[model samples]
Every structure is written in structure tokens, then in C-alpha cells.
Target chain A: MKNIIIASTSTIHGSGYLDYILEELNTFFKEAETILFIPYARPGGISHDEYTNIVKTAFTKINKTVKGIHEFENPVEAIANAEAIFTGGGNTFVLTDMLHRNHLIEAIQNVVKNGTPYLGTSAGSNICGLTIRTTNDMPIVYPPSFNALALVPFNINPHYLDPDTNSKHMGETRETRIKEFHGFNPQPVVGLREGSWLRVSGDSIVLKGHLTARIFEKGKSPCEVEPETELNTLK
Target chain B: MKNIIIASTSTIHGSGYLDYILEELNTFFKEAETILFIPYARPGGISHDEYTNIVKTAFTKINKTVKGIHEFENPVEAIANAEAIFTGGGNTFVLTDMLHRNHLIEAIQNVVKNGTPYLGTSAGSNICGLTIRTTNDMPIVYPPSFNALALVPFNINPHYLDPDTNSKHMGETRETRIKEFHGFNPQPVVGLREGSWLRVSGDSIVLKGHLTARIFEKGKSPCEVEPETELNTLK
Candidate 1:
């Protein structure tokens, strides 16, 4: 059985870090007294200690204890013994690299497979998918491969933004990028927008947010699913 | 001597393909009657033949011939004999992957180093940088490495856009992303906005266009460099 909260972003507009989702997190992690935080992504280049402290502040408001994975001598052991795990948002490339190099990918996935609760935002959420093929982050570093945890059947494009009709920029739109990924990959993808998240409980995964998510299939046009929609429809 | 046109994009807002830069390109490739095009980036998932034909149409207006690398029996030999080279914009991951897999990275760099005249727009221009660490494209595929042509001293963030103050998205801003890149890598980067480019001649690379280019250094605050400014000052 698997239990995870994969969010498109940690913060929403006009909200503090994890403020928008703290209520849900408190319920999702109610069973755990102390949650281990993986701050490898280091959003905006903050140090692991610094990033962990931020997550700690969020968990404190929910009456839970938080500890960074870096605090432990062995990261694999840290994940193995953790009551729960949370990976914050940052550069996906660097996060994936650290996870692979530290040999914690399998360790973390193993714990999650046994139903250790997992929470991931943005870059962290990207790794829960089949591959990190649809990430929008810059390739600041190269990992061994794009392979990632198979916690989910498909990939995800977090913080998904629609094309700005009035904008003049000529860069490829997010949809075009996902389509390009499909051109090379067989995996379907979901464009998870801000404030949107997926709640995975064993074999059941449901969209649990106010906004609708854009689902992209290999050969079909992108379609939208409303909040609370069952994601098994995608499979 | 080196001759290169590293553009921010192939087309500007409200312009035809390559229409904004055709005059400069005509002057840049004045000595060549036919130029080789590397359409490996495959912008918007278009095929090589289709992308090549688009380039052909643009070159036709300047009274020059265009040929894609795929059209040749030997890509390496084609590069060695190319009068000039033009690599258009698309996905940087795919572009870099194709260059490395086909063993054309060094071949193309060699000609550009020896003054064969080169034009790179968007993804194409990113290769001229120290690394493809600052590209805005999605990681649709994985390349063997992040190492690029290193024709220039710094990396480039092509089609760079300023953070929209009114926007509600919580993803890292472009500036934040580049700053994060610097935290791991020491290389400085230039955020080249659309319609701006660097005109490179032997021992001289000057910023050209009406707008300014944003320069980001490892330990210093990012600043704007004036149009027609010399990039050598940053180096």
C-alpha cells in the first residue's frame, strides 16, 4: 500500500510556505509524531539546514516535529527509520542527483511502498512519477538517468501554466513540451496546476484540490478533470 | 577568427520565421552561398525535413541555399565541408542529445572556432555557452552530459522573461532559478531577452539590440548591461 501527497507547489499565491496545505498535511501525517524532511532540492540555493528549518516551522504550526535528513549520519538509514517523509520543492535535477548519489532512492521508495506517508511538492513530486521527463526546472546538474520512483503510473508536470495568449515570448509552451516528451516517451502525464494535488491511498488516487488538473495522453488531446476526480480514469 | 550570431530566439513577436534576424544573417554569411542547417532540436515536435524546409524558406529570401545535416550521407563530413552552419531553436535537451549521440559536438565547435560562421538561436545559442545549465526548455530527454560548446565564457538563458509581479504562480522565478544554478556551479550567466543577441567576432563579443541583457554573477547582484555593450568586460 502507498500513501502520498504530491502537490504542484509548496506555496500558493499570497500564502506562506506550506500554509495553504498545512491542514491537509496535519491529517495525512496524523499518525507520525516526527516527520523527516528531505531538503535536497534547496529552493533558491538555500542550504539544507536552512531549508529544513523552513519546513520545521510549517510542521510546528501543525503540532508535529520535523527533522532534516541531513541531520542523520546515514541518509538511507534516516529514510528507513523515518515515521514519515517530506521532500520540499527546488531544482529537480539537483534533487534527483542527490537522491541517486546518496543511494537513497530505493531506500525511500521501499519505505513508501510499505505505506510510510510521503509528501512531495514541485520538484519532489516530479520524482514520484515514472520519470523526470516533464520537469520544467533548469538542468543545473546531470543525474545518472531520468529514471525515478514508480510510485505513480505516469509522470507529472508540476506548476503547470497555460500559454499566455498576450505574451510575446517565442519559447515552446508547457503543452508543447509535454507533447515533445510523449514524442520520445510512452508515459502519459498530468499537468498539475498551482493549488492542485493528488492523494494516493493504496490503489486509489484522487485529485484533491480546488483547481482542475490537465491530463495529457500519448495520442489524445489534453483533457481536464475536476477536483476530487478519481485518477484511475487516467490509467 | 570566429564569426557567430547567438540569438535569443529565431523569431521575434509578430515576425515571420527568422524575419527579425535575416538582414544580420545575410551580412554574417556574406561569403557563403550555401549553409548547413542542424535541425536536430525539432521545435514543436516537427520533423527534420519540415524544419529544414522552414529554414530553406528563410534562406531563400536572402538568396542563399540551406541544407539540413540529416539530408547528408555523413553528418561529420557535411560539417567539415559546410560553408557555414545554422542551428535553430527547440528543446535544448534533445538538441544536446543529438549533438552528442551523432558525435557532432566537437565537429561543429571546430568549424565555429576556425571562423566557418555560425548562427544559433534559442536552443542553438545555448550550446555556445559554458554549459546548458540555464536553458528554459523542459528536460524532454537526457543527454550524455550538460557540457556544451564553451564557445563563450558564460551560460545563456534564452528568451528570458522578467518575473511578472502580478502573476500568482509559485514556481521559482527565472532569476531565482539562475541564482540557484550559480549556487552549485560558479559560471556566470546572461539572461538574453527575446530580440536581443550577441554579435561575436574574433576576440570581441558585443551585445546588440534595443533592450538590455541581464548579467548574473556568482557572488554579485545581477545587473543589466547596455545594448551594444562588450561581453568581454564580464569575462
Candidate 2:
């Protein structure tokens, strides 16, 4: 059975890194003594070592050691040998570009599907979808392809925010962007609000958290689904 | 000599479509009797005819006729013979994809370089840069390449927003996103606020509109430049 926790973000507002979800992660990663961290996203252009150190500090709270894939000679081998894997948030395009360039996409996908416990937050969670078409991040760098792990049947719009009726900004809302994605893409999209996550076990993908998630399908009106809902039925 | 007006948006809040810039546009396109409209962006997933009709109504006020390039049997020829060209805002990925698919990138570049009057708003303005790497739009579709017109020396981040100091949202601020772009891209970027534009006349690119534009250059602190400032010195 596949075990995974795909979170909208690692840190919520007014919270430390991964602090809000540390309790759940303690149980999720209980089986593993160490986690192999993929810090390719490099949020805010932080160095790989700096990014990995941050993840290490967070995982330490759960009594688990963390090591960055960059420290290994072969990333594919690192994924294969990892007891558990945790991919942190940053720029999705940068993360995807590095994942493709380092040939870790298939390696990571194979291990995750073959029963390795996995955790993905933000940009990391984005790569678990069918494609990165629904990401809100700016396209700082172009990847070889928009194709992703296909770990889930649908795409994810992380940090999903609803339209503020009082705001004067003219930019497209998170919902509008997803609708635009549906115009060209056929996959269903989950607008994952902060503090929300999808718990995947075997063939079951259940939404978890107190807030509701906005579900978007091609040619259909977007609807809201409550927590504990089965998202695998979206397709 | 290049004559172009690259706007941050087509409409400001509480305003009709192109209402604010119509007066300036009237004087800008005084020499042209007809405007060839490229409605490939398709904001809100509207059809080409519908998007073109909106532009037609706006241009009619200036005593100019508007025809969508899609109406032509040969789009390449349509660009070569047009008196003036206008590309409106929508999804940047969609617009870039169509521009590449129809092989109009080179055609548009040629005509514009040869002194064809050009106007681009939002996604259209995005294409006038060196690459579409700084766009805020979601990657609804993959284009053949990120390379753009290179009409100006630097990239343009249209509809630029300032960071909300009081918001609890954890999403990356606009400034942070642009800074992230600079991490990978060496080109300077202009954050053109709503109602702001870049007026390109020959080799001089001047900031227009009342609002001050934010300027971001690689490895430097972002600064604000007042309207009418010449942006050609960015590089």
C-alpha cells in the first residue's frame, strides 16, 4: 500500500516550519528512523545546505534524522535506499527542473509507489499531480516538461485562496486560474487551502483538515468538498 | 523605429474595458486606420470571436476598425500587411502557445521591428519581453519555448502588486517572486503596476502613467522608479 501526506504548505501563517503538522508527521513517519529530504525547491533562493538544515531541524522534533539528497553521490540511489522521503516547498519550476535534470522523477516515483512512506509540502506536493499546470508560482525557469509523478489522479493548486470581494486587485483569482487550466487540461484540480492535506493510503485518497477544499473539473462548476472526503473519486 | 505601448492591464478596478487608456491609444494609433487584433490569450476561456468583439467595441470609440488575426486565412500574411497590431491580456501560456503554434512569433517580431505600431496588454505585454518566465498566469498549457519578442532589454511583470503588510496569507509576495525570478534569470524586470505602462519609441522605453513602477535587477535591491523614467538603462 502507498503511504503519503500531501500538504498545501509546510508552514501556516503565525507558525514555525512544519509546526502545525508535526503531530501528524510524528505518527506518519514513525516507522522510519531517518528521512531523505529533497530540497531542490530552495524557497526564496536559499542555498541547498541551508534549506536542508531547516528540514533537518523540523524532522528532529519527531525523533527522526534527516539527510539531503544533494549530499549523496547518486540521487536515484538515495531515493532507493531511503526509509522515508520528505520533499519541502519552494519554487515548483525550479524543483521540477532539478528533478528532471537529475533523472530523479522516475526513481522517486517508483519508490513512492512501491510502499515507501512519503511527505510532500507545497511545491513538493505539486509534483505528485498529473501536471504542474495549476501552480501559482511564477515561471522563473522552464522545465523539460510539465509532466509529473502521476501519483494522484488530479492536479493540485496549493495555497488556494478564494476571491476577496473587497480587494481591488485585478489579477485572476485562484479559481479563475484553475478554470483556465481546465480549458486546456482535462485533469481535475483540488484547490488545497493552507492547513489542509490529502492522506493517501492504497487506493484511498481522503481530504483531511477543518477547512473545505474547492474541487474543479473540466466543463463543470467548481464545488466545495468538506474534510474527510474521498478525493480519488474525482476522476 | 519600434512604436509600442505595453500596458499592465486592459481594465482597472471600477472602470470599463480600456476606458482609462483610450485617450492615449487614440493619439498613439492616429496613423493607422485598422488594427489587427490577436485574441489568442482568451481570458475567462472566451472564444476568439467574443474576445475580438470586445476589442472591436473599444477601438470603435477611437475611429479605428479591429479585426482578429483568426479571421484571416493566413495569419503570417495577416501580420505582414497589418497597419497596426494589438494583443490583449489573458493567460500568458495560452497566448504564447498559440503564438508559437501559429508561427507568429517571428512574424510579429519582424513587423514590430520594421516600425508597425504595436500594443500589448497583460499577456500580450508579457510576450514583448525576452522570455515569458516572469508571468503571473498559471501554466495552463506548455508552449514550444519560453523565448519571447525581446522587444525591450528586460522582462515585464505586469499588474505588479505590493506586498500586503497585514495579510496573514503565506503565499510568496510579488516582490519575493520577482526576486526568485532573478535567482535564475539574469535579465532585469519591471513591475508595472495597474494603470502603468511602458512606452517604447525607437530605442527609448519610458515608464508611463501616474504610478511609480518597481524595478528589479539581478543581485540588487528592488527600487521604485517614477513615471516617465527611461527604462532603457536597466541592462
* Top DockQ model: 2
- Residues A83-160 of candidate 2: C-alpha lDDT, one tens digit per residue: 999999999999999999999999988998899999999999999999988888999999999988888999988999
Q: Report fnat in order of the candidates.
A: 0.90, 0.83
What are the models' TM-scores? 0.99, 0.99
Backbone clashes in model 2, listed as residue pairs: none
CAPRI tier for the interface of model 1: high
Q: Give DockQ per model, in order.
A: 0.87, 0.88
Candidate 2 per-residue lDDT, tens place, B169-194, comes to 88899999999998898999999999
Error of 1 at B68 (Å): 0.4
The CA lDDT of each predicted structure is 0.92, 0.93
Worst 10 residues of 1 chain B by lDDT: B226-235
Candidate 1: lDDT of B162?
95
Task: Encode model 1's per-residue lDDT on A1-235: one tens digit a residue.
Answer: 8999999999998889999999999899999999999999998889999999988888889999999999999999999999999998999999999999999889988999999999999999999998898999988988998888879999989999999898877888899999988888888898999999999999888998899999999889999999999896564
Candidate 2 displacement at residue A210 in angstroms: 1.3
